[model samples]
Target: MNLKLEPGTLDDAAHLAELRALAMRPSLERVGRFDAERARQRLLQNFTAEYTRLIKQDGLLAGFLVLRPQDKDLLLDHFYLHPDFQQRGLGSATMELVLAEADTLGKIIHVGALRDSDANRFYLRHGFVLREVAEFDNYYLRYPQHVPLRGV
Candidate 1:
């Protein structure tokens, strides 16, 4: 699919917000928390161009993800793919790429999936272990492994 990740810019925040809404709608709806305006606001409030990356497929914007550095690990946040891009292996491929980078740095990666979302299964399948389940999200952590994974 010629997937690529480009550095994000402040101007991309609005587009990323829309993408986030589209990607999280199904999961958010399942938990009665789908609010369009709120979603946009949240993305804007936390958007960090320095850490965000826009995902493109064959040169078209397809999704975005942010990996923020923590004291001893990395926080994987706001990972969203356009609805059309989901279930097509793009997300898994993206995760694998990030996981490889984390392993290379010998740092743990933390991620949170919304409750009742398919993301939970996706993260688990990728070797992320559950660390906690909050009211609205399930937190996970993947420790560094020197060996690379196959068939992600």
Candidate 2:
């Protein structure tokens, strides 16, 4: 199926609410009924003039990608395709857009995922180099790119 990555808008807040509810599952499983509302609030704080996007397949909110709009350096945050959409290459396409945009703008990007997350492996395979572990109780994994990856 074809995919679309379009800029997120205030209108998409409800979809975000829906996604955040699902997005919290892994964290909730780890932390037990974690406060996703709080997480959403915290996440929203990071939203700036950056051009965020709601990933769509056939015009549905299949997933989303948010990165710093101006910097070559970006934080790929809250990227999740629905459970039904997972394993369907939608996530990959979204990420490729992130990298393509980075490469176009001549910037590097960095992100941290949970150490045990499948996303960590995905990032590694996508040219994100493991740089360091992080602080905080959960001890996240840090991955970084200094430029468009050499081999693609």
Candidate 3:
């Protein structure tokens, strides 16, 4: 299995959108899909570059990650893995890549875990601490504790 993160192109928009929709629905039952749609759009609009990645095992996008930088924080804007990709370590592997990039830039990584998700647990296992829990969701940070060291 190999994972890669690279700039996403216009051609990836549709697949990326579909991935977001599939990954978000379980959490966005009552919410509209447009939320993720708008966020993705805004991301492309503001940044001259968009970082999109895929976790591939035998040439399929098993999982995906996206990020946008702000101030000193590399906000993990999006993450998704097809159900088949879940629990196979691909998500975790993809995240290690994301965190490593943030570390090289000396940025603290901040991610808002979905309001109710196993994502919180996953983040915790990965050396993140719960900074705050909101009615809407929870925030997590991984720094000094497990901040990415330079990667290969």
Candidate 4:
């Protein structure tokens, strides 16, 4: 797919926030929690340009992701794709890259998806195991495995 990543900057915050809101609308609406302003504010609240990258396909913005390093594991935060780009293997490709990086560091990756979101199945299919279920989200942890997991 010729996927590429560009380092994100604080200047991109507003744009990223817009993208996040658009990408998350369906899931949030499905869970009866869709709030336009809140969605943008939430991304701005935790946006760390240093830990984020803009995904590009053929030199166009496809989506974005944040991989924050923590004391015990990497956090897979803010992975959102444009509606036009979903269900085309880009998300899986991005995860494979992130997982490979985590494997090299021998660290687990933690992620939380909106409750009842399609992301739940996506994470599970990528080897993430459920760790917790909060009122608004479902937390998952993917351990670094030297050997490939079947069906992962």
lDDT string for model 3 (63-150, tens) is 5666777676777766778777788888888777777776667777888877667788888888888899897678988784344445
**Candidate 3, 121: how far from true, in Å?**
0.5
**lDDT of candidate 2 over 1-152, digit per residue (tens):** 78888888776765675676676567556745467676567556665424567888998878776676334356665677777788888888778877776766666676766554577778877777777775422222223335645687
- For all predicted structures, in order, the TM-scores are 0.94, 0.76, 0.76, 0.94
The candidate that achieves the highest TM-score relative to the unseen native structure: 1
The list of candidate 1 runs beyond 4 A from truth reads: 147-152
- Best candidate, lDDT: 4
Which segments of model 4 are wrong by more than 4 Å? 147-152
Residue 39 shift from truth in candidate 2, angstroms: 2.8
Question: Could you tell me the lDDT of residue 134 within candidate 3?
Answer: 90
Residue-pair clashes per candidate, as listed?
A: 0, 2, 0, 0
Stretches of candidate 2 exceeding 4 Å from the true structure: 31-33, 69-72, 136-152
lDDT of candidate 2 at residue 136, scale 0 to 100: 22
Q: Per-residue lDDT for 1-152 in model 4, tens only? A: 99987899999999999999999999999988999999999999988999999999888899999999888889988899999999999999988988888998899999999988999999999999999999999999999989565697
Name the TM-score of candidate 3. Answer: 0.76
Ranking by lDDT: 4, 1, 3, 2
Q: Which digits, one per residue and each the tens of the lDDT, describe model 1 over residues 27-88?
A: 99998999999988999997899999999988989899999998999999779999988889
Q: Estimate the overall C-alpha local distance difference test score of candidate 4.
A: 0.93
